[model samples]
Target: MIQTSPKTFRLHIGIFGRRNAGKSSILNTITGQNVSIVSDIAGTTTDPVEKPMELLPLGPVQFIDTAGMDDEGSLGLQRLERSRQVFDRTDLALLVASSNIWTEFEAKLLEEIHNRKIPVIVVLNKTDISPPDPEIVKSLREANYTVIPVSTLSGEGICELCQAIIESAPDSFVNRPVILSDLVGPGESAVLVVPIDKEAPKGRLILPQVQSIRDLLDNECISIVTGLSNLPQILSRSGFQPKLVVTDSQAFKEVAQITPPLVPITSFSILFARFQGDLQTMALGALTIDNLKPGDRVLIAEACSHHPVEDDIGTVKIPRWLTKKIGGSPQFTFTRGHDIPDDLSGFKLVIHCGACMWNRRTMLSRIERCLRAAVPITNYGLAIAHSLGILERSLSPFPGLLNTLKTTRSV
Candidate 1:
């Protein structure tokens, strides 16, 4: 049986260009599939279309084909806004333009891509009809951009475009960080506490749990998966000791009690705080919880959308916890999936999910946005641990972080 890699693990390559500029054609040609609707009519793609495939040598990649940035009118503006959001998650960008056309649309798009500091490959499409203007190509090349001339109609330069994508991928994707492998060394054992609950999928474990187990195995470490009921038994086993203990954020209190003090403890969400976003920044953000006042606006953001359970972590539990911590009710706003608010400045604090469904780029982008808006941002795990008054204990795995937290608290 073959298993497909999750979208979160794939490099996000966004294809940006104007209407009817053969953006869809370029995507279809590259993936060898009709991934997006191809039509001569402008604005054919009203929403971003994503295709995930193995771009070998570079491994898994997600290609996002977006609507034209040059879209007009009210409805067109909405589509354009959606396309702009793609910049937040794009690890690499492919700027597609017709060989003969150089307009404000392309210039603005390129400027936005540069502002995000995303590596780009300029694809001058329709080269078979008219070779890319020498002056335009020279200007792009002089700007240190990798320019690839292609004709989707004739398949010319497709191989070169593919090669350029491989070469331009972000270094972080190439040298991906381990989720928890570093915490548990080879030949060492780590306990994973996963409580099977209503929110848990019908049969399979959640993405973060599955990925955690895989990470340990990949590094030749032993992973012992269990529930809260059996955690004590696993820990009490004669002559058996694990290097670390990881649990769901909801079960942190119980798992912390069951595990030995010598063993490091953390949660999947907290691990992802470091894996997907800036850990130190978030740790500091969690510190701001003490300063939250009643009625302060807080944004709880989840990367995936699902029906809220009675004790939904985001909508229900976390809010209850925060209210209890603050001794009063605070105004809470929730956002799911890619529906990030246009203005984050209104919020006093932003509590994000583990972001198991999103790439690191998207998570980091949100963090950067919060920083720029002067709103402290933290993940579910860090916030929960801090609220429970065991954040320092949970952070014991990283001694340096513990010291940093101590110094910050002292100050």
Candidate 2:
């Protein structure tokens, strides 16, 4: 898959439409494979279907096929919500409409796209069956939308459609990945500290750890791996003085204590902050730790869907650490998986997981929502380091940025 990594070039284009509007069919024709299941029934695709491929002019691209927007009933409403969720992360939106009908559903979706400032292409699908709608053409054209009629089955106008999508996509999303990789120069040494615990996957490293290592390798930077128990030893014995140390948030205390003040250090979560999320917003959220009232409500968010471990950081460890630091009991609400609470004003703060499995677009959208709501959102590592009273030390990696933020916020 083409990573939407800040180091790689990719365009995240999402395909959306009403039930069975040939969204999947259009995808199959474009990709030349049955990547998404096709069905006559509406709401067949409950979850967003993703595929990554290289288009000639566009280089690498990711396509997301979502469920119909007009789905009904309880289950359909849930599916509809899932489809809407894709909007926040999409760099480009393709609204697949049937030539037979154009309704309020498309208009509302377009309004949201406009609000989000995402460029869109209104696709009139199944053109082989019927002529274009005059009202649809007039309405969309007046609004300055590019509407193209396409036949997925007959394979008509597909080449032109692909070029149009490439033309409409933002250049920033395609180039963000490359900028992140350029932050650290080639041939420098970086250390990664990963702690192995019950929550840590057995016989395998987490996605974030592996991806960071791979990114370093790709840039020709030398990396040394160590566990929390022997991080000090690893630093002492390594041949070179490491330029950066990346660690798991669970081991932030020990890592911060052992590492010398000169050598830069940070967590995998911090790297995500700089690359996948808004670092400034999270920095502000971390500052809210001092003001958490005794009875104030806090929301703890996690992304990966699974049976949380007994020592889950998001559930047990983080809550325990915060309560211990505050020295008072506070109301805590836990929302796991994708069920994030809509009314976040009830909570004073929202502490989110590192979001290893989710893409950058989704993470930023979640942060943007928190910004819009005026609710502070900090991740597992920042919250942990903040509560432990060693945030400045934990953020030793980017001394310039970290120290500047820490110095300004320190009381």
Which structure among the candidates has the greatest lDDT? 1
Question: In terms of TM-score, how similar is model 1 to the real structure?
Answer: 0.98
Per-model TM-score, in order, reads 0.98, 0.86
> Model 1: per-residue lDDT, tens digit, 1-411?
988899889999999999988999999998999999998889999999999999988999999999998999999999989998999999999999999898887888888899889999999999999999999999989999999999999999999999999999889999999999999999999999999988888989999999999999999999999988999988999999889999999999888888888888999999999999988999999999999999999999999999999889999999999899999988999999988788989899999998989999999999999999999999999999998988998898999988998999999
lDDT of each prediction vs. the true structure?
Answer: 0.93, 0.80
How high a TM-score does candidate 2 get?
0.86
**In model 2, what is the error at residue 21, expressed in angstroms?**
3.1
Per-residue lDDT tens digits of candidate 2, residues 14-36? 89889889899888889999999
